[model samples]
Target: MSNKHTTLRKPVLLTSLPLGVMSFLLPIYSKKLGMNAVEITGLFSILSLILIITRPIIGKFTDSFGRKPILIVSCILFAASYFIFSIATTSVLIYAARIFQGIATATMTISTYSIISDTTKENNFSKAFGRIHSYKSTGSLYGCIIASIILSFMTFTQGWKMLFLIFSILSIYSVIEVIKNIPESKKIVTVKCDINKNKSRNTMKLLIIVFMTCISSSILGPVFMIYMQDKFTNNILLLAYAFFPALISESLLSKRIGAFSDKCGYRYSMIFGILICAIISIITPSANSILILAILWILSTLGGVLYNVSEKNIYTDMIGESCVGVMYSIYSIVCDFGLMIGPLVGGILYDNVSHQAPFYLSGFFMVIVAILILILIKKDSICRVD
Candidate 1:
């Protein structure tokens, strides 16, 4: 990787640390604040709904105005979100935080991916994206560790505030890094383009796959923490320990799998990955022991690692370089569409149906995703650039 790529990832790494903490705490916190299952999931749906609206505009700005400014704004918004999370006493405040967080995600995620696409060679996309994801994993792991420690020492309320406050400060540090070190990734360009028919078709197929993948994954989001709390001990440290293996394995292997995807076909890798995850999801609801659940989680994460690394590279391969930012935003919009629906459905299923319903449904959708991949994404489309 070049110095520029390295620099770009630093802010991403830093921000991801806080994101990890938020992921671990947000649902639990929402529950504590008297939110029901549907309400808890609604927060995420609201966030994704906002992303669907905002990401395209911000993504276009990145392509036109350059990546650096949008990235810096993203960092600041992250800090703002963290601060709001820190002070939140009601669901309304949490809702506001999700809004800021969603917008921040729209900007930072699009800008960072665009930067990687701008800086790296086409063939090296998986390797480069792998490293970026690995960095995010590393940061998230450490963030969880830190959160565990904080929760270990303090009351839940105190620890929650402290975690958000500390990460809010760290987000500022990321902002400074962006201002000082990161360079603009691409020259400013207008988004006008005459897209090819094949490229457009491939991009649409890829986005459909992404949408299904999001649904399959997000179906578990609203229920995961609640399930853990009910089934396992509520000790934050123990929860973190259970998650450690998956995070560690994902961090270590993301880059390697990316490199592997670069050599082997992304289609094969993605198909295999999705099937493995689908199998795991099918079995997860049956695990009676915490250890079995943890094991299942680890396997599921590995499958996700494979699927995500390969899928990202394939999208980059399919889209034109000039409108990559817009294309990525569009991709995210489709993915968020799934995210918005999945959690609501998951929450309702958990509340009205059975706890296992979401997992079963997720697995079913994942199988559909795999089928879609097999039929829609042809070998010729993946192997050769049109």
Candidate 2:
């Protein structure tokens, strides 16, 4: 194992606690702020728009300026965004925070993954992503428990704000970690600002697959808690509990799944994973009790771990280490696009149609992506062997 791979865990672990806290709390907190589902989705869509505009630029700058400085700046901005979130009084202020967070997110995503790509060997890339993801998932699991504990003692908005404050503190620590722990990677040719040198036939196809898969996966984002609210109960602790199984599954299974991809081929692992997840998405809507819901989503979470590890592995390999920031920027754009639009569409469907409609639509899209992946497999373009 690369020394940097072990070192990489520190920053990923530190940064993810805040992100994990936010991910579990955001929708629930936004609802407490009296925002509707469409408003929440719109918030994310706007955030994605900001990222779409900025990530490529951040990537370009990181590629030329070096990853560490950009990464440090991102951490600073991320901490500031959480400060903004903690004191946000209006939905408009939340919008401002999201914009800053979006920019921070773009820089962080491209720089961090690019660094991982630079430091880790190509052969170990799958395991690297999986391990990093496991760390984040584990952090998120603990974050949910932390949020639940806070909520137990305080009001919903107050608990959420406290979580934001916790995030702000952790992000500041993340900045220190970046400067002290992470060594700078290769200083690439600085003047090639075109940002278009990395695109290939395979990359476009991969991006399309990624976009579809992200849309399907994120389609429930705006309305999942609402669905849970409608079905089981509206308790925040219960919702926090609901996130537990998925996070645990991701933490435990990601490394093993990555190994599976290494041996079985990325294509096989991804296809099987997606099919399981897609089929489970269909069944999840029918879950009438917490036991059934947990079981179904836990399975979906396992599938998620499988597909996600393989996807990042293949995507990183195809893009190459040198072009990490630029290509991942493009990758982030498509992913953010999917994540943004899915929620908007899902929120609309959830409000207008039945609550179950979003899940159905989401499952349908996953099936489409699964079919798309199948076709690519037939063409021998999507699946690659190391």
Name the candidate that leads on lDDT: 1
TM-score each candidate.
0.90, 0.89
Clashes found in each candidate (C-alpha, N, C closer than 3 A): 0, 0
Over the stretch 1-386, how does candidate 2's per-residue lDDT look in tens digits?
A: 55776665655665566565665567666777788877776776777799989988988787778888888898888888888999987788888899988888788788878887787776666677777778778767666767768878998878778888887888898889888977888456555544455676777887899988988898898788778887789785666566677778888877777766666777667888898888888888777788788788788988887888778877887776556678888888889888877777888999999888888888888888877777774322333445
Candidate 2: C-alpha lDDT = 0.78
Local accuracy of candidate 1 as per-residue lDDT tens digits, 123-174? 7787788888888898898788788788889999999999989888999999
Which runs in model 2 stand beyond 4 Å of their true positions? 21-24, 27-41, 155-158, 187-197, 377-386
Could you tell me how far off, in angstroms, the CA of residue 128 lies in candidate 1 after the best superposition? 1.4
Model 2, C-alpha of 384: deviation from truth (Å): 14
After best superposition, candidate 1 residue 230: deviation in angstroms? 4.6
